[model samples]
Target: MNRVNQVVKMHLRNKFTWFLVPWAILGANFLINAVIATSLNDGEVVNTGAIASIFIYTLITGTLTLKETFPFAIGLSIRRKDYFFGTALTVLLVNTISGLAITTLSAIEQATDGWYVRLHLFELGFLKDLPFIGIVGINIILLVNLYFIGFTISSLHRRFGSMSMYIFFTAALLIGTITSYTLTHFGLWVEIAHWLANNYMDLFWWMIPMVGVYMIISYGLLRKAAV
Candidate 1:
């Protein structure tokens, strides 16, 4: 338990990576979108979707976290299991906090009428209709899911090298293409969109299981990974 805490501390030591960078990018994105929204006509709503930058940044950090820290932690005699748990704990804590912050900002955006510029950066579309807790829950789930996705990919690379990554991505691309083709051929896009609109939160909940699977796969790979 102490070892896991130590691992968490080690990762948190790099405050710039875990804290500053994502928020900086999000702030910059917000400012740029705000400026654009201000130039638009009155009553026109601008749904920038720039809020996604933070989540995407989370994914990048997840991939980089293993590459940057795993070797050093291993060299320090940290157990792989402890390191994995510690990393998971760190992400969960961070994402929970992030979720709260985002929800608060969304509320503020709504109250302020998009910061008085009609910019719908945070309170965009369907998310605006959800309750506070629901919004936060979805945000945390989405962030954690993206993080583990990157972590799992990094783990695969660590365990199997470049060739494995190539193969993995190739397979993913092929599968994605086929899925898209099939969906389009069946003309299921309208139905899928309607279903998603009605049960978007359910989709986020479903990601919880996949996040667990990613964690399991990452732990298994990291256990046998070379330093």
Candidate 2:
């Protein structure tokens, strides 16, 4: 337990990577979008979707975490299991904080009528009707899910090198393409969209199991990863 905490502290030591960078990117994106929104006509709503910048940054951070920290932690005699647990805890804590920050920003956007420019950066229309807790829950789930996805990819690379990653992405691309074609051919897109609209929150909850799977895979790969 103490060792895991140490691992967490070690990661936190690089505070810029885990903390500052994401928000800095988000702030810059928001500023640009806000400027654009202000130039538009009155009553026009701008949905920049710029809020995703932070989540994408979280994904990139996950992929880099193992590469940057694992070797040093191993040299310090940290066990792989402890490192994994520590990383997982850090992910939860960081994303929860991020979720709260986003939710707060969204509330502010609402109160200020989209920062007084009608820029729908955080309080997106699709999510506006959800309760505050629901919004926070969904955001946390999304951030955690993307982080673990990147972590799992990093683990795969660590376990099997560049060739494995190339193969994995190739397969993913092929599968995604085929799935899209099938859905389009069958005209299932409309139905799928309707289903998603009705059960959007439920979809975030479903990611919990996938995150568990990612954790399991990452742990297994980490156990055998070379320093």
Q: What TM value does model 1 have?
A: 0.96
- Where does the lowest 10-residue lDDT sum fall in candidate 1? 121-130
C-alpha TM-score for every candidate:
0.96, 0.95
Which ranges of candidate 1 are over 4 A from the true structure? none
In model 1, residue pairs whose N, Cα or C atoms come closer than 3 Å (at least 3 residues apart or on different chains), thus clashing, are none
Candidate 1 local lDDT, 119-207, one digit each (tens): 88877577777889988998899999999999999999999999998999999999999999999999999999999888877888899
* Clash pairs detected, candidate 2: none
User: Which regions of candidate 2 are displaced past 4 Å?
Assistant: none
Worst 10 residues of 2 by lDDT: 41-50
Residue 5, candidate 1: Cα error in Å is 0.9
The lDDT per prediction is 0.92, 0.92
